[model samples]
Target: MLTAVGVPAVVLLAAGADAQRPVEKPAAAVVAEAPPCCMELVAPAPAAFSAGSAAGGRIEWVASSRASVREARALPAGVAPEQGLQVKTILVARAVSAIFPEIQSIGGVRPDALRWHPDGLAIDVMIPNPGTAEGIALGNQIVAFALKNADRFALQDCIWRGIYFTPGGARAGGYGHYDHVHITTKGGGYPTGGEVYYR
Candidate 1:
C-alpha cells in the first residue's frame, strides 16, 4: 500500500506508462475551440482608395468595399514599409507610450487590428483599453494628431473618435472606445496594422 522514493522496476515502469496517456478534449468542445480564421491580413493599400477615413480628420469606414472596410489600416504616424512594423503605427504607439508609460509597458495603444484603412492612409491603431481615461486620452490624441497633420498622414478614418462614454460609463477621451479603438490609415489588410476595435 506504500510506494518509496525508489520503487521496484516493474512498478515504476507501469506508473510511467500511465503518465504517458494523452488527454483529449471533448469532441463537441474540441470543434468549437479551433474556430476558423475569419480575419486575415492583406497587402498595403493607398490613402486615396479607401473611405474609412473621416471628413476633416474624423474617423470613418475603411473602404467602400465592406470586406476591406473592416480590414482598414489605422495609421500610427509615419510610413515605412521595409520595417516589419510600419513607421506610422510605431510613431502613434510611441506617442501614446510617452503620454502613458504604465499602460504602454503593460500593452496599451497598440492596434487590435491594423492595415491599409482604404480611407486614405494605412495601419490601424488599436487601443487596448478603449474605455479608460488613459484610453480616452490616447484616442483623443490619435484623432487630434491625424487632424493636425491632415496634409501629411492623409488622415484616414478615426472611427473611434466620436465614441461618447458617460462620466464613468466606460472611461475614455473619446466615445465608447473603452473596449478597443480602431485607427485606420492606408495599407495592406494582410500582415496587419495593429488596431483594436475601440467602439
Candidate 2:
C-alpha cells in the first residue's frame, strides 16, 4: 500500500512539472505575429495648386524683370533655379494679384543672401501703408484668406508685421516683414536654422 501511494505521488508531481514547462513556439511563427519595429509607411503627396481651387480669385502670372531674374540666378549655391522667381513663386504672386488688384507691387522668389528663402515656395506682397488702419485691415484680410485656404496653396506659413501663422496658429516674431506679407509653401522644403526669420 505505501509503495503504491508513493508511485501515485511521483506521477502527479511529474504531471505538474510538465504543465509548468514552457512550450516552444516556431521562430517563423513568432516573427509572423510581431510587427517590424522600423516599418515605414508611405503617404500620398498633397494636392497640387490649381486655378479652380485658388483663393481670392483666378491666378494670373506676372512677368518678372530681367534684373530680378539675373539677381536670383546669382544667389548662393544650393539655391535651385526655381527658388528664384520660378513657376511656384509666379503662381503665388499671380493669385494674390488677382485677389488684390489694388496691390500695385508684389515680389516673389527673391533670393535672400543673409537668410534662407524657401526655394520656390515664398512670396512677399507689399501692404499699402502697413502702419495705418486700412493697411492693417488689408493685411488681416490677406492673412485670413491665406489661413482659410492654406490647403489650396499648400501654404506652410505666413508672416506679417512680425507675426507668423502656421496651420497650428499665429505667433509673433520676424524681421523686415512689417511692410510686406511673407508667405511660404511646404513644397519648397523647410527652412534651415539660419533661414528662419524668427528665433
Instruction: For each candidate in the order shown, give its overall lDDT on alpha carbons.
Output: 0.34, 0.45
Which digits, one per residue and each the tens of the lDDT, describe model 2 over residues 80-165?
23335433344445545545555777665555772325365677778889888677666666666566546545677888777777
Q: Each candidate's TM vs. the true structure?
A: 0.31, 0.49
Q: Give candidate 2 regions above 4 Å deviation.
A: 1-83, 86-88, 114-118, 174-176, 188-199
Task: Give me the overall lDDT of model 2.
Answer: 0.45
Model 1, 12-107: lDDT tens digits are 011011111112333222112211111122224433423445222334333232222332222233222324444444444444333333333322
Looking at candidate 2, the ten consecutive residues that score lowest on lDDT are 9-18
The Cα error of candidate 2 at residue 12, in Å, is 80
| C-alpha positional error of residue 198 in candidate 2 after TM-score superposition, expressed in Å | 33
The CA root-mean-square deviation of candidate 1, after full C-alpha superposition on the true structure, stands at: 22.8
